[model samples]
Structures are given as C-alpha cells and as structure tokens.
Target chain A: MKIGIMSFAHLHAEAYIQNLRAIPDVELLGIADDDAARGEHFAQAFNARYFDSYAALLSAKPDAVLVCCENSKHRALVEMAADARVNVLCEKPLATTLTDARAIIEACERARVKLMTAFPMRFSTPLVEVKARLDANEFGRVYAFNATNQGEAPLQQRAWFVNKDLAGGGAVMDHTVHLADVLRWYLQSEVVEVYAQTNRILYAKEIQDTRVETGGLLMLTFANGVFATIDCSWSKPPYYPTWGGLTFEMIGERGVVLVDAFKQNLTLYRHDLKRAAWNSWASDANQAMVEDFVAAIRDDRPPRVTGYDGLRALEITLAAYESAERGEPVRL
Target chain B: MRVGIVGAGSMGVVHAASWQQTPATLAGFFAESSHDATRLAEKYNARVYKNYAALLNDVDVVDICAPTHLHHDFVLQAAAARKHIICEKPLARTMAQGRAMLDACRNANVKLLVAHVVRFFPQYALAKQNVANGSIGTPAVVRLARESARPKRPPNNWFFDFEKSGGMLLDLMIHDFDYARWLAGEVETVFAQSIATENPDAPLDFGLAILKHKNGALSHITGAWAFPPPNFRTAIEIAGDAGLIEWKSADTAPLEFFLHERAGDFPDVGLPSSPLREDPYTTQLQEFYDALLNDTPTRVTAEDGLAALQIALAAIESARLGKPISLAEARA
Candidate 1:
C-alpha cells in the first residue's frame, strides 16, 4: 500500500512513519505538514519525499493517508483524504467536537473508503485476549470496571495537545478516548453518563500544563450495569516508573479480571529472593497489531480499528471534558 | 485430592473455600491454636489438630497457611513427616529460618512450594510474560504496591510485631520487593522511608521502600493496611526502552497489557480488562500439587522466600535507622 503522510503535527504522526516502515506491504510515498520544519524533519527521518502542502501530497496519488495532525484538523484532513479517494487511518480524538467527528464520518461514507482510527492499543495482544475471555464468560456477569491512563507532564513536550480548542480538553480529551473506546468495544456497551474533573497542575505555560486531570477521577456508568471509574491524568514525572500506563479492572459475579498495561513479574518472598520465580509464557501484541493491519489492508477488509470505534471513544472523551468543565456529570 | 489446610484465619478460610470450590478435597486442617483450628475444621468438615507434627502426619499434602513466624517450624515438621507442602507468603520470618525449612524439605525429598499467589494472578502472569518476551525492553524500573482498605484481621495482631510479621515490609511490601528482584534482577541496595504507626498503641501499617537493583533497575514498593475497606490491591510496573508493562490488581476489570505504539504518541496503547475464574491461590496450590505429583521442584522455593524476607528486613532496618541499607549490610 502506498501510504502518504498527513500533517505531522500530532505526536502520533511519528508512529505512522514507524509503522509504515515496519510493514513490508506499506510504502511511504510522500509527507506534508503545516509545520514546515516538522515536515522536513519527518521526511528526512523517514526518508520520504516532502510535499509542500496537503494538496501536493494528495496529488501524489497514494493508496492511503494517515491523518496524524491535531484534532481540530482531523475533519479537514479526512475530507481531503476522502476527496482524493484514499483510505484514512486518523489519529484519535478524530475531531475537536462531535460535529467535526460526525462530519468526518459522513465524508468517509460519501467517499466510500475505509476510515479507521489509529487506536493501536486495541490491537494489543493482552487486550484482545482479555476481550475474548470476557466474551467466553470467564469472569461471569461483568458488573463494574475501573481504568487509568496516566503519565508524566506533557504540557511542555506537546503544548498543543492541552489546548481545549485544538486538542479538545486536557487529559480527559487526550487520554480517555482510548480507554473509553475499549470499554465500548469490550463490553459491547456505551457510556451513558460521566462525572469527571480536570486540572492543570504542572504546566504554567500558554497551554494548560496538564490537559488531563491530575489526580482527576471520573465515574462512568455504562449502558449495562458496568460502572467504570476512570483516571486519565498526566501526573507523574517525565521519567515516571511506567512509560505510560493504562490499567483496566473488571469485576464480575464469578471472578475479577485485572489488566495492567505493564506487569513483568509476579513473585513472592519469605526471607530471600531465590527459588520463588513464577514465570508464564504469553506473546506480545504489538507486532500482531501491525501485521493484522497489513493483512486487513491487503485483503481490502475493514481495519481492526474502525472509524466508528474512534467516534465512540471520541464521544466519551468529549463527555468527560464537558463534565470536567461544567462540573456535572455529562450524559452521552 | 484430599487436602489438609494449615492456619484457620481469614486466609485459611479463603484457601479452604478455594479448595472446596475447586476439584480438590479438604480432608483436615491445623492451626497453631486449637480454637481457630476447630472453627475452620468444623466449617469445612475437616479434622483439626493442635500439634503441628500430628497435622503433618495426617495429610498427604501440608498447606502451610500459618503465620510467617511459624512457617519455618511448621515446614520443618511437615518435611520430616514426608508431607508435600504448600506454604503461605513470607515463607519465614528470617532467611535462616527459611533456609532451614528448605534444607529440611530437600532432605525429606518432599516438594515444598511457597505460595506466590501474585504469579497466579492472570494479569501478573501476563505482565511477566510481556517482560520475558521483551514487551517493555529490558526492565529498568519497577513501581509496585500492595494496598488495602483496612485490616479487618491481621496476622495474629502480631503482624505489627517486627519479630513476627517483620512489619509492613515483610507482611505486605515483600510481594512487590520480590517482584522487583525477579523482573529487574538483584537488589544492590534499598533506601526506604516508613510511616510509623501514629498511634503508638496501633501497629505499623504503612511503609515505602526504594530498591536499587544490580542491573540499575529501580523499584519502589508502597504498602498500607489502613486504606478504606475491603480493598486489596497489588500493582507492578516495569519500564524498558522499548515499552512498559504494568500489573494492577482489580476488584473489577480484566488483566491487560499496554505497549508502546508510537515513539512519542500519547495514546500509546489501551487494554480491555480480561476476566478469569482462576485466582492466585488455586494456581499456587495446583503448582504445589504438580510438583509433588511429578517429583518437580516448587516454583517458589524457600530460598526465594528468604531473599524477599531479607529485603523486607532491610527496609525495616533502613526505616528504623533512617539510612540507606545495602543488601550486603542487610545480609549481615
């Protein structure tokens, strides 16, 4: 697949470059971004041709385009990709507003092309396995859920990401969508209401230092009896213990399922550290996701991460943002 | 198989219930004191014994759910009786005690398995798998915790007594310390700060320890017994150059793993809660049974338990003296 790069404004844009390189079937045709310096940097780093503008990049007639630009630009980017009759793998928070998200979806519909969100975590192995297990009724009646997506400060690193107009909301908007989408996808349910709080504790720059709430907690009541408590905060130090953490816990009638994005070993100690080693064999899911995406595109099938899925996740993120801003539970 | 349960306290009951829930049969039980023993025995329709030696002689397998202070003597008694053993955590109060138990079990040719239930937790196991498979590059840092709401019942109230439970370090934080050692490798040194029980009348219930591993992996362990209510949690985080993995205990949610999707993309990964019916206790017990049946070494051996205990003891020493304690000094 000849993949052309959209604006390299979002941090996720770099990932598209890497993923495109990782997949043998995908070829990087050209790249463009409003930030001339960033576009040049990306083009030079990925060894791709630099297009002066989105129009020039579209003119190159790539098979697909990855929209790794800011949320505010997602709709326009998708529309451009659709006008050029190219598939899109848009970065999350598909749009700054629901209206923009809907418009992007409609444009993709009108274009008759695939519009998959770049929610790569869904393609992770542990999550896929967990989803299967939940479907198998391993935990029984999934009664409640709690999730956290946390990290250190992102204000100085990616200032634009904290802007409510550009990035939507802080952590609630930037981080919650991925988790919110998983809740919907795994439970086959939608969030009905959300009570959330957001804060800018760390950053004192032009953009909110912490877009997501630091120590911000949210209570999400799903369509089913699945009550979810979510914390989407960038509250740790830059060199936080976990690179970036997403924790999901599900409670059921029969048992409980707890998923940690990062867990290496589970051991016990009495008086020393030797002889107490509990090791299990499980495969990693990153390569699987990339491979699956390659296969899906090769077979002309819908991607594992659909645009509609992105829409749902985006809705929840917006809801959380609204709830935090209004100081009330925002109903979906 | 007909099983004998040692210890008749809260965990003893939990174990007995878990065994009953499984295909295993509970034939008898033994408690240090006859009262708790009789209570558990009557509830489970099993025999109760006051004498550890007599209890060892009656059962094919000895499930050592006794207090940490009693693990050494009970395990030695069980080993001499030629009973396969499954011992609860903090295998012994001291490394010497743990080593003696291991030596005795080895001489008797009886399989001795120290219960490291965290390994049995599916989420933790998955996290371990991720680390082994290089999910997060080489494990660099581990931040873990064993937190609870409040201690409804403690280890004979002696848990606060350092000679018995080794305070929060051994009774609780030892789990994560062992995990850090396992995933990140040897602990070269540890610096810890502890919250002494405010009410001198009360026991020490909270502690925090920072471990510096031989391989430069930094681990942080925090534990508290006075949380809220009915909240039992264990969380482990391992970060590597490539990605990160975290195992978080959940009352509700499935076990999940998160990986790096993009270099700097904020929405790196997401995980759906994976549910499971099997718990750490059952898995540990099964491991014990398998080791006994197959003439295999236990997954968590006595030596490993001792090492973890040493770390806990070191933490306590560090806290007490308000100085960083090297493993060498700890060993001494």
Candidate 2:
C-alpha cells in the first residue's frame, strides 16, 4: 500500500510517519505542507521527498493520504482528496464545524472513496480487550462512563492549536471527539444530548492571541440511556513526564472496568535529563491504527473507523461547543 | 464544651470518634431509629436522647450530622436554644433553607461551623497554603475528582432520594465545590451534567460540574458513585501562571510540582515527610472547638458553607434546566 501525508501542522503527523514506515508492506511516498520550511524539514529528517503543495502530493497517485492539517483546514484537504478519488484517513475531529464535517463525508460518498477518521484509541490494546469483554457480556449492561482525555498545551508543538480560527475551539475540539467516538463504538449508542462548559484558564498567560478555551468538560446522554462525562482539558504542566493521558471507568450491572491507555510506562528519574519522564513501553496504538487503515484499502473495504463515525463524533463535540456558547444542552 | 450529635449513622459515628480526641465531652446523640442511637451511644460511651429537643437541652454544642433534609429544622431548633452549631456540608438542601439557618445562627450569636473537611485534609491544606503564598503565581485553573463506591444503604435510606439528599451533586460533590470556591474565589456561572440510575434495582450516580469563577479562573469538578466498595479516590490539579501542583489519592508519591522555567529559583516543593496522624475530621472538629474557646474565627464559617451550597444548588439547577446558571441570576 502506498500512502502520502497531506500536512504536518499537527504533532501527531510525526508519530503517524513512524507508524507508516514500520509496516513491512507499506510505502511512504512523501509529505506535503503549505509551510515550505516545515514540510522540507520533516521530509529531509525522515529521508523522504517533499511536496510544496497538497495538490502536488495528491498527483503522486498514492492509494491514500493522511490529513494532518489544523482542524479548520481538514475540510479543504479532504475535499481535495475526494476530488482526486483518493482514499483518506483524516486526523481526529474530522473537521471544526458540523457543516464542514458533513461536506467532507458527502464529498467522499459522492466519489465512492473510503474516508476514515484517525481514532487510535480504538486500536489501543487494553481498550480493545475491554470492548471485547463488553461484547461478551462480561460486565453486564454498561451503566455509565467517566472518562478523561488530558494533555499539555499544544502551543509547544503547534501554535495554531491555541488559535480559535485555526483549531476550531480549544480542548473541547481537540480532545472530546476521541472519547466521543470510543463511547459510541463501545456501547453501540448515539448521543442524544450534550451539555458543556469551557474556559480560557489553563494557558491564559502562556498564550495571548488565542480566544479559545483551554479547559472543557462535556456531558453526553446516549440513546441507550447511558450517560458519560468527558473531561477534556489542556491542564497538564510542561515539565510533567509525558504530554498527557487518557483514562476511564466504565460501570456496569455486574462489575466496573477501568482502563488507562498510557499506563504501561516506566517512570525514569534521570540526572542527565534534569527532569522526570514516563517512558511508555505500551503497544503502539498508532501502529495498529495505520495497519488497519492499510488492510482496509488492500481488501477494498471501508476502514474500521469510517467517515460517518467521524461525523457522529464531530457532531457530539460540536454540540458541546454550542452548548457552552448557548449555556444549554443541545439535542442531536 | 458538651457536644450532642444528631443522627447516629456513619457521619455521626465519625464525628463521635473525632470529638473523643478533642476536649469536648460527648453528651449524647439523637437518631430517628432508636436501635441506631443506642448502638452508637454504646460504642461512644455516651447517652441516647429520645428526641432532638432533649438532646439540644443537654449540650452546649449541637453537631448536626442528620439527613440533609433535616438540617434546616435541626439548625433552627439549635439556634433557638442558643447553642453553637457544627453542621455537615450542603448546610441545607436548598438555598432558602441555608439562608434561614445562617440567619438564625447569626441572630442567636452562636458560631455555625460547616464541615467542609477537604479544607482540613493535610494534602489539600498544603496545596491551598501554597496557592495563597503565590507559589504558582496567579491561579488560573483548578480540577478536582472524588470517586467512591455507590453507597449501599437500606431501602429506607434518605440518601437514595434526590429530593431529600440533593442527589450526588449536593451530597458528595459539594466537597470539591467548596474546595474550588476556597481556592478560586466565588463562582460566576455553573453548568453541569449528571445521571442517577432510574431503576431502583441498580443504584448509582455520577456528576460533573464546571464553574467559571469571578476571578477569571475556571474549575472542573467531578464526582462518581459507581465504583465498588473500598475504592475511594480523590485527585486535584491547580494550574497558575508560574506552574502547577497535583495530588492523587491512588498515587504513592506525594503532591508533585512542575514550575515554569521562570520559577526555577523558587524553593523546592515537597509534601510533608511524615503524614499527619490526625484524621482530617478530628482536625476540623478541633479547629471549630478552638475558635469557640479562644473567641477566634472558625476555619469554615457558616457563610462559606452557604456559598458552597449556593454553587452546588446552581449546578443542580443547571443540570436540570439543561443550561448554565449564572450565580448572579440564581441569587436574584
């Protein structure tokens, strides 16, 4: 399978590149970014060719392209890919607005091409096992979910993340969609209502231009009667071990299942580094996600995480933003 | 000082044990159930009063650890008897009741101390002290989580009744609400989401509340009553311009600090080497007794309790209305 990357705006693009390279049968064609310097820098560092424009990369005839542009730029890139009749595996959130999200899905559907959202958590080993247990009725009917997806401010890696226009919103847009997709997948339910609150508290002093919210908490009620809370915040401090973490507790009729996606880590206190760090030895979820995407293309089938799945998750996230803005719960 | 405890359940027993470590004498206790009152009195080597009024006549201090719905009546009767009062949190189920309780205490010239015990926990106390000292610069954000097993009470337990206990938001999460207000000042607005199992056969509740503080800080508060027994955990994070401070009950390490580069010269932050042997409940009771004896101010005043209750009630209202409630609007 031949794959190209569309933009390097998101830091995850670096990890996805490694994931693509590790697959024995996969070919990494090259990378493209509007910013010439950033595109060339990574292209050279990874020993790959650089395309100055997204269109130039699409012209290379890759089987699929990974969209890693800023959230607000996703719709344009995905539409461009749809026009080229290329398969796509866009990053999480799909797009900033529901209109843009729907447009991306519609374009892909019209072209009869596969469009997948990059939800690596679906491939996380522990979470996968938990889901299997739920499917097997190991915990009985799930009653509720308490989840958290937290990370450090993205300003350290990409300043555009804190910019409202570039990133859509803040932590709500960045983190909520991941868990939203996971819960929907796990319970096979659709969120019917959303209530959210957000604030520009975590990075108020660190960044000035962004009017986005850095902290957010969302409450979602599903059609199946299960309710969940998602604490999506950029509250992690810079010097902490890793950038952030994901954890959840799922309550059910028979028992409760707890999962920490990044728990398989060794805490290191190194004098040379002058700071503590968490060295993760966990199975690479990104690698699994990339493999799944490649297999879906090879089999001429839709990816396990499809664009509609992305649309659904994006809907919940966007509703959360609307709820925050209107100060009320939004019905799906 | 003679302390008469109202209610002979878990909180009453806890208060009884803590008072034993103080200078106050355990005069007696009143309970709706004679069996519970007798059992508790036997264990504490105290008397069992047949009625609340009789208990009030026998002691100088009335410690109201009864069901939340009864707090208003207990407080009013105690105030009428001119006794110093120590009430368990939520002060009352409604703001009107809380106001009346506060007013009655004030008019009688008796100290009213509400048990917001998180303020007395050594770990929490140290964090508050550091914040007050401006160790982390100007506080900007706060997050708190308290999780515990669903209370397995008899069918007749009032806690299972939302109307009487105010559900999980007012009963359990009010601790974090009080702590957040104590750290970040008054809340300007609140939005929340919550779920209580409608099926009486499966009893559990979870709540998440977001408070936008008047000081430009924001607080994310989460409480869960879905875990199994012997599985209580609490975690807190406070972020400011200069750095962050974090603590978790499940982690072996003490409170951790990650100061910004500009704060490199600040003193090393460390938790107390030896954990304080005193129970926080005992410490809080001691503080309350000392204030009364020394004619000093109580650590958690009636006004503080009232304010925290107001926020909790507002959060409940927000959850009910499916909208955020401004504190100003709620007050009006």
Best by DockQ: 2
- On the 0 to 100 scale, the lDDT of residue B214 in model 2 is 89
TM-score of candidate 1 against the unseen true structure? 0.51
Would candidate 2 be rated incorrect, acceptable, medium or high by CAPRI criteria? acceptable
Measured against the true structure, the TM-scores of the candidates, in listed sequence, are 0.51, 0.90
Off by over 4 Å in 2: B33-46, B50-54, B198-201, B253-275
TM-score of every candidate's chain A: 0.88, 0.97
| lDDT, candidate 2, A149-178, per-residue tens | 988988898999888898988889889989
**Native-referenced Cα lDDT, model 1:** 0.70
Q: Ignoring the other chain, what TM-score does chain B have in each prediction?
A: 0.85, 0.92
lDDT of 2 by residue, B1-332 (tens): 99999998778888998999999999999998889889988988899998888998899999999999999999999999999999998799999999999999999998889999889988899999999998987677688988876676767778878899998899889999999999999899888877777655555677878788888787888887766554567888898767788888878445545545563332211112225589888899999999878987766788999999999999899888877789988788
